[model samples]
Target: MEWAALLLLALALCALLYLLGRWLLGLDGDLTLLWAEWRGKRPENELPDKVVWVTGASSGIGEELAYQLAKIGALVVLSARRENELERVKQKCLEISNLSSKDILVLPLDLTDRSSHEAATKTVLQHFGRIDVLVNNGGRSQRSLFVDTKVEVYAAIMELNYLGTVSLTKHVLNHMVQREKGKIVTMSSVMGIMGAPLATGYCASKHALQGFFNSLRPELGEYPEIIITTICPGPVQSKIIHNVFTEDLSKSLDNTGDQSHKMPTDRCVRLTLVSMVNDLKEAWISDHPYLAVCYLWQYAPTWAWWLMNKMGKIRIQNFKSGVDADISYSQKKKA
Candidate 1:
């Protein structure tokens, strides 16, 4: 009887210590080691002629990425819905590179259309011969509540975010696998790590992407030089805030939110570029509230992430801002 009582007391003490340890980690859980390890493993840069495709390049982070890659001498193909915007970006990149305008190709593509991916790839192949890196950074975002959202809204989000990426990836995977060399860098939001209350469809789509890529990451290792990288960052300073879909199931067409508090698009693009060059599997850009929520919900238990994500009212109100205000698609948020 005495032994049993002692064992129970010891178990309670151990449980208490375990909870205390977890609380301590929660208080100071920094990923400096992970960052250092990733920094140490960056691969050498590819040559100038390596064909790299940047989708959603009409504006935002995609344009930034295209510009950065051009500076590094990589042949770039920029795609988006707006050819005019794409042309502006291409011209800027050429000026930056001191290279001929022939080096950059502008292909406008609607990501929601799965059939469009093959045609776009064919154009890239015709112009550049073959692509060495494909950056899938095109997609729409949402700011609707799960309870208030229509069923079709979910489907549309999936079609654009998840299926759209998969379709494009499928189109390129065969060629990349055959050549045994390619880089597939996906732009998924930090919301991919944890769903927020009012951003149901966006979160779901991003989460699905994380699952798909994580499962496929190891499978791609069979190809000697193929690299698959997924990037997740907090709210980036961009037109995405103005692009929030409304509670009435309507997408906003004007900018009406606080864009000042968001992270700079250039910084996000540079980080993404460095991650890709380094062959990182995953990256999370640091920021305020959202960054904290990313961890509190991801490593936390089931209900923990849920409760933490719900601690906000900004999601619904952002819906009033016009999604159309994005002027160009957001490659960072689209990631």
Candidate 2:
């Protein structure tokens, strides 16, 4: 009887541990961000009636973000280089949400145009009276070997992804500092956390963002309510591949491989809102393998390097063969 009771207890413990491990593996985001999604302040509760300025609002994650924010009752300012696309996103937002035409502002912006950022900030503030949140989502990615790519391509990537973001943030941060309260959420990537092949420039840009925001957070110690949040999302289904800078600035990616396997855009934006509301200093939003690698990168970097070496080879081969670097490896596993 004693032996049977002990055996049952051991089995129960093992079962519990197995389930816990499974749950962790299934998670699409870091523990902190997911915890905020599950139990922390909800976006609906926190974001309603707030003014949110989202850059890169013409497509991809930015477009999806506009739709979600509309549903949540947040007043949104949509900006990108293309006015026509911004209008289309605004119209969709109007159709889906209760917000009227005046509630959604379509301001055309070119992030690379640093001269216009100050005036852009004023325009948002003039219409809204105050800027409550700034979503620095404007940026491009790269897909080329460092040796093959021109120095100009690297300069352009930094100009748009790093310097452009910083320029906009500078203008907005001045306002946030004056108000002494708001959220500045920048859409970084898992690429920011780890280095990989075919994206040397992209990784460097994101690293710059990570270092910038991480350092900026400390500088704003005087204003506790002014939250600086960095969102590092892994591959979510988007048109990012179509826009990636290749070996030369004049060229574009010919094959944007299967994005079907990536995490859904809506899911990523939803968690981003959660991180914003909860005031998380930094959040990692991504699905497995990448998410797991983020942990290895942070805690056990030597092991992370070993794993990346194995994975990087596969990524380079996929790029060379004109297949989606991310999908080919996973699809092979599924096969």
Candidate 3:
């Protein structure tokens, strides 16, 4: 009995050490991933002096990204639907520093409009003479039940999130390729990898982003100078929830406002910038590195994440499927 107890204790210690090594130390596979990153060797900063266009720069992550890039002397072009809001954000950026005033350019656009993207690109080139980076970050969330969703809702979400991003990138790719240098930063969500309830359309769009960016990365590598990056983050404490579409296909969404009070917006955008400048292929952000662990355990036969998600509030069982099922539908019609 004494010998058995000692063996069990030793086994437990070994298990704990293994877990600690993998978790805290990050000694998992793909050390080559970090090695692949450009890291300290940035290319004499083609980033700052050249034009960098940011989508959805009116608020939240986009707004913060614009300001941060501006601070770095990046000639940042801001785009979004809300002209007034974008103006306010641009003004605030200018107020923060004079570097931003000369570098920041506000050009409001609805990503759903393909022509707008082309026009925006033209404007950027006309204004700054060259486009060096494109940040595709403008996206909305759907908080409706899948069953009650209208086809329009799904179409709209896909049009804006997937098609819009691809269209803009496609428009500017020729120039970037000709220049033989550029960076494409795509913003995906944690929900992109892990499907959350009541977000079928949103999830599909984000997953599409991952697939599209991943495939394009290799092609861009042909240039060896153009870098492609995809970012995945769990919910951040932002106004994104307020903008999420509900069942009624309503723009004014207040029902599913994510009040979880999680990560700060500044920190989130800053990390995204760091990841971008470092030329990282991918980065996953969350309170914990659960997303990285998910990547490690993704190949397991059983869908352990599905089982684990089902047990947590993150799964959101009460979520309705289609737009009609969401409370925002009726609320919007009433308004």
Q: Write the per-residue lDDT of candidate 1 for residues 1-335, one digit (tens) a residue.
A: 99999999999999999998665433211263246335554322544677888888877778888888888788888988889999999889988895678888988888888888898888888998898999989877776567766887888788888998999999888889888989999999888987666677888899999999999888876785989989887767755555555455465534454455556888787677767777778887645455556666767756665655344433543444433222122223332
- Whole-model Cα lDDT of every candidate shown, in order: 0.74, 0.92, 0.72
What would the TM-score be for candidate 3 when compared with the true structure? 0.81
TM-score-superior candidate, 2 or 3: 2
Candidate 2 C-alpha lDDT tens digits along 15-92:
999999889888888988888788999888889999999999999999999999999999999999999999999999
lDDT of 1 at 44: 28
How many clashing pairs does model 3 include? 11
Question: Worst ten-residue run, lDDT, model 3?
Answer: 322-331
Write model 3 residue lDDT over 1-335, tens digit each, in one string: 99999999999999999998666443221233334333443323534575778998988899988777776667788999999998898887787755646577888888888977777888888888888889999989877667777888988889999999999999888779989988888888876666656788998999999889889988776799898988777667667877887666655554543344455777677667766777888877654434444463456515655554543333343342212222231112233
Model 2 residue 60 lDDT score: 94
Best by lDDT: 2
Candidate 3 at 53: error in angstroms?
Answer: 1.0
Q: Rank order by TM-score, top first? A: 2, 3, 1
Runs of candidate 2 with Cα error greater than 4 angstroms are 1-13, 329-335
lDDT of 1 at 261: 51
Task: Note the clash tally of each candidate.
Answer: 8, 0, 11
